[model samples]
Target: MKKILLGTICLMAMAACKNEPEKSTQAVVAGESTKAPGPVEFADQKYIDMGKASLAKFASGDIDGWVSGMANDVVLRWSSGDSIKGKEAIAKYWKDRRMNMVDSIETSKEIWLPLNVHQPQSVESKGIWVLNWHQVHATYKNKQSLTFWVHLDMHYNSEGLIDEFIQYVDRSVINAAVAKKK
Candidate 1:
């Protein structure tokens, strides 16, 4: 009878402890902002389609179509710190390289992601941005071929036209390959 009574008392004590609220173990830092992160909108289909179409136009030698979606004051920047401003200048640059310099260019393993950034850092603008990654097989006019991965970020203005394009790639490898003679 004593053992039964002791077990019942232990169960009652455990039940009382279980009714207590849990205490947080996380330490609170002084002056730390408890702000929540900004909202992120993912996979806007139109931007993805536009990005894919732009790349397709470029690979198929349709320079005009590729540039048609760009804003009038578009800016294109390369990872090598080279930049081309204005839609006309960007078109000219692409024409010269695609028509005269490159014989054939093909893209594989392409990925496109579109996002609307509700809030961004000070250096970034809040708008639609499309991110692309692809493996390119490019043949120079000199018959030299190179296959490399490329990353590009295209920022679109409110009118759904691309205003900023940033291309990230190793320019040295491309320059060396282009400089090679047949």
Candidate 2:
């Protein structure tokens, strides 16, 4: 009985915090101060679609499709300090190396996206969380399946589109999986 009661209380607390405006280290999404260049609309369905499309393409190893899905002037911070500005250059990197290092890769994008609704008008982020994707079993060109977790410190744009895409999968997992062959 006590355990059940405690669980219920914790559940209520978590629910109450769903919309509690936090993670303002960055600004809100819809802070359109009446004058900002290309002020993006917050909670934009279009943006979400773009993200969903990009995620699908990446997971599927569709390099061209993934690049096409991003905004022209994309500001990508893939890691804590490794930031890649502009979609064109980023595209080149993907084409050169990251595109087909593997023959195929699968990810559970939607199932892993953060489901936080703690903000105003979709422009303001009530909070942020680390998005941990399901295990990705990627098959290399030689048909070797390497399993790893794709974790992202996701940031949503004004359109509720993920402007910044970061990947935090443990490379060691891939290394170990591949090491077994050699």
Candidate 3:
């Protein structure tokens, strides 16, 4: 399952990036290793740190805190086909982004805690896999359910901050939590 998912994401990335971020794998000369990282440099430690910081702030709804992390001119496209650009646009999009749930509804933390830990992904020629889709299995409350990994592909921005996210989790788990109201 994991192998199949990764193969699919690789194919998709190859197709989408064919006309875009066309695989730029330059030879790492001795002199090039010492230079500082650019804003969109996702492979470097700094880029990962900045991206994670932005996500942490975004999750907390600290707009002022995370806004600076984004580039002035940025474009965001959702799987739903809503495309937005610029800082103001991003801010406005975030305004109503909060989720409200009933008493029986579960917290995101509850669902995520079990699925968040993962093995490191190898760096390919292109960008890193920001949200590698893996599987999560659940049984009874007292029973110990295990995870069998699957491939889920998610995309982020050049700055390393996640501008997009799409995951293929267990359909049963996702539908129970995100199904439209009757």
Candidate 4:
């Protein structure tokens, strides 16, 4: 099942990028010139970089490094309808429950997509928002393993710190895995 899901995600990603225009070193604006100006950069590259780095740290079980990218007042909302506010509380929650329960986590696949919306308010926002699709393989301390998909919608503040993180995952899979161990 995990292999099937991973394969499907890979196909989807390939199909999504198939139709994209070939990137050139220069972006033509107002039909200026054929010569490229310079390498184009994504507007949200920094936020994406920070997010990827945080995920890498999490995958490597570096809880401290992962939490370091968050804002002091970061708000984290879990799919189980629990909300943790402030960096300290979030760290404690993870350390007590999550980090302790899960022996290790490995990301099988990740895709970062822009928030597709057309609104003036969204356009004028001070921060950038990204939706990340993550397929993770988690192993519990009891040696139980589960592969799950998580959707994370993260908002980065102007200082490039994650201010809001909304995680969507099916908790039943994890619950069942734990129940089977008992």
Q: Best candidate per lDDT, number?
A: 1
List, residue by residue over 78-117, the lDDT tens digit for candidate 4. Answer: 8799899999998887777665688888896899865422
Residues 9-85, candidate 3: write the lDDT tens digits: 99998988766656668778874775654423333345445545555665465766766655566555544455677
Off by over 4 Å in 1: 1-37
Each model's lDDT:
0.90, 0.59, 0.46, 0.77
**Model 3 local distance difference test score:** 0.46
**Model 1 clash tally?**
0
| Model 4: residue 65 alpha-carbon error in angstroms | 0.7
TM-score per candidate, in order?
0.80, 0.52, 0.38, 0.69
- Clashing pairs in model 2, backbone N/Cα/C closer than 3 A: 19-118, 29-123, 30-123, 42-158, 118-126
- Between candidates 2 and 4, the one scoring higher on lDDT is 4
- The 10 consecutive residues of candidate 4 with the worst lDDT sum are 116-125
What would the TM-score be for candidate 4 when compared with the true structure?
0.69
lDDT per residue for candidate 2 within 1-83, as digits (tens), equals 99999999999999988986665475546844545533223333444455556677877767778866455666666434567
- Candidate 3 Cα outliers beyond 4 Å, as residue runs: 1-42, 99-182
Q: Candidate 2: misplaced stretches above 4 Å? A: 1-50, 79-81, 98-100, 113-132, 159-162, 175-182
Q: State each candidate's clash count.
A: 0, 5, 1, 0
Q: Among all windows of ten consecutive residues in candidate 3, which has the lowest summed lDDT?
A: 105-114
State the lDDT of candidate 1 residue by residue for 77-152, as single tens digits.
9989999999999999889998888999999999888988888856667889999999999999999999999999
Q: After superposition, how far is residue 105 of candidate 4 from its true place, in Å?
A: 0.5
